[model samples]
Target: MSRRVLVTGGASGLGAALVTAFVARGDRVLVTDVREDASVPDGASYLRLDVTSEADWEAARAHVEEQWGGLDVLVNNAGIASGGRIDVATLEEWRRVIDINLLGVVRGCRTFTPVMKRQRSGHLVNTASLAGLVHPPGMASYNAVKAGVVALSETLQFELAPYGITTSVVCPSFFRTNLGASLSGSDTVLQSIARRLIDRSGTTAEQIAAEVVRGVDAGRPVILTDRPGRRAVLAKRFARPVYEREQHGFARRIKEAAEGAADRSTTKDGA
Candidate 1:
């Protein structure tokens, strides 16, 4: 059966991949993004939606009601990245990240839950990160918001179950995406390192999108795409101290690499 699906941040990266996947499967998709220049799949409709704006969500709901009558899937994939030590991050910075990454998901759920409840069958796919499950340094704000996403999704899963509404939290590791382009904060070196790692990683947005489809089909509450994400979740569950140690070591390595890059730059400049 063809279902009505909506994906936020559907302009690029994983969002675009998801849009393509759903469209290929014959689902009527509505792709929304805050970017005015965001692209939609050939058969899918496009809407300008800022997840942080309640009015935007209302407009989306109205559009869905008018066009599709109701929605079957809502993918909260819109988010921003932030990197900086907790102490160095300003209050404004924290609020900005939280508003978009955490509160955005909140607004999405709040807006669509009632609609889905009325239908008694709907899926909510929220895009979180592995950082939400296993925290590392220099990403306090991002980690916190993503973790909140996971928590919200988990709680909603229980609350919405009786209503036949499904909720899944996607916790993926690094993949090739434009998330780096919108990163905010003082961790330039860390961001550069992360960008390089993601570029070199074997994962792709299409691959993650496939996993997402499979997970939703299977009604999985927690969806993990990459090996690192899977392992981290396992370690965090079975061996929390071990996971904490690994996170600390990873943070140390990033710091060391950043320092090494700085030293090399200094050497080249002095030459």
Candidate 2:
């Protein structure tokens, strides 16, 4: 049976990888994104969707209803990258991030819940990040929104289960992707760290996508997409002192790197 799957932000990066995976598996996929050039994999469909817009979500629902009759899977994967210290990131920036990252997913869920409830069987995949589970310093907006995603997914896992629905929140560690292109933050220190991590990660988006698919198929509630993230979560759960130490060390590294960047800037200005 070919499942009806809809993936938001399916133009590039992890979303694109997921679209490809679904297509390869003979699923009927609707690839949606706000971008005009949202790439649709072969044998998949495409629709323009801005998760921030209620109208767009409604249109998506209509499309699904008319095209597939019902949706078996909905992947809320649309979000921008952000990293900033609490005070460094302005209120406007915080609101913007929350609107798209958190509220966006909220909109997607609201749009599709009725459809799934009627069908009495569906799966929701919400793309969060490792930051959602473990809060490293700097990335307040991203961390907060992703954490909200985790909470929302968990809530839906319970709320929608009665309707025969399953929810999975994907918490992927740093992976090689163009997510950095959308990265926004006033804190240069954290922004640089995030960019570097994304650029240097050994994990590819395809790897994460495969893991996400497996986790979803298995009906896992919390899908940690990488080994390091899994270990971090385990440490956080069982080794409190060790987790605290690691967090502190990571924060110190950010501070030292910020100081180094400032020193280099000063030297350049003096010259």
Candidate 3:
């Protein structure tokens, strides 16, 4: 069965890749993003959207309804990155991250859940990062927002199950994307760390997108994209003390490296 799908952040990166993949699968997909362009591939519709705004969502919904009657799949893939220590991060920055990464999904659900409920058979996929399950070194705001997304997705899964609407939460480790480049605007410290993490992480946008489509096809409620993430979650559940100890040591090592770089700067200045 072909699905009428709507994807947020569909102009670039993982969203773009997902949009393309869905189209290839013969699904009618609506791609929405803040930037409008002619680059969207053939057979997929494109719409301008600012996920932060209610008016934009309303318009997009209207467009989807006019064309497809109702959506079968809603992929809440729009998100932003946040970095830096919690103590040093600005209130404005925190609000921006939360509004886009967390509230954006909330708003999408609020607007679309009723539509899906009326249809009584639909699937929702929310993109939460591996950061949602286990906090990496310094991404306090990103971790909080993504963790919220994971919780929200789980709650929706149970609540919507009664209505025959399925929900899946995707937790991808890392991939090459402009996410790190954008994070640099908000926090150089976080951007630098993001660059390193992406360099070391496995999986690609296409691979994640394939898994997402498969999970929806399988009616899965939670989808972890990589083995390490699954292992980390299991370790946290079965051996929490060991996981905490290891996480603490990992964090300490990152902090030590940052301090070491500062010491090098001091030495260079003295010379």
Candidate with maximal lDDT: 2
Comparison by TM-score, 2 against 3, better one: 2
Q: What TM-score quantifies how close candidate 1 is to the native fold? A: 0.92
Q: CA RMSD for every model? A: 2.2, 1.2, 1.7
lDDT tens string, model 1, 1-271? 7889999989988999999998988899999998776667677999999998999999999999999999999999988878676666788988998999899999999999999999998999999999888787877888899999999999999999999999999999988888767775776776777777678878899999999988988999999998878987889899999988987897898779778978999999999
**Tens digits of per-residue lDDT for model 3 on 1-271?**
6899999999888899899889989998999988966478888988988899999999988998889999999999999867777665788988998999898999898888999999988888999988899886678888999999999999999999998899999898788776665674544555677787776667678887888888778888888877878888888889999899988987786687678777988999999
The number of the candidate with the highest TM-score is: 2
lDDT of 2 by residue, 102-141 (tens): 9999999999999999999999999999989999887778
Flag regions of model 1 displaced more than 4 Å: 239-242, 257-271
Deviation from native of the Cα of residue 65 in model 1, angstroms: 0.4
Ranking by TM-score: 2, 3, 1
Question: What does the lDDT read for residue 76 in candidate 3?
Answer: 94
The regions of model 3 sitting more than 4 angstroms off are 185-187, 264-271
- Clashes within 3 Å, all models in order: 0, 0, 0
Cα deviation of 245 in candidate 2 (Å)? 1.3
Each model's lDDT comes to: 0.89, 0.91, 0.85
What is the Cα-based lDDT of residue 270 in candidate 1?
Answer: 100
Clashing pairs in 2: none
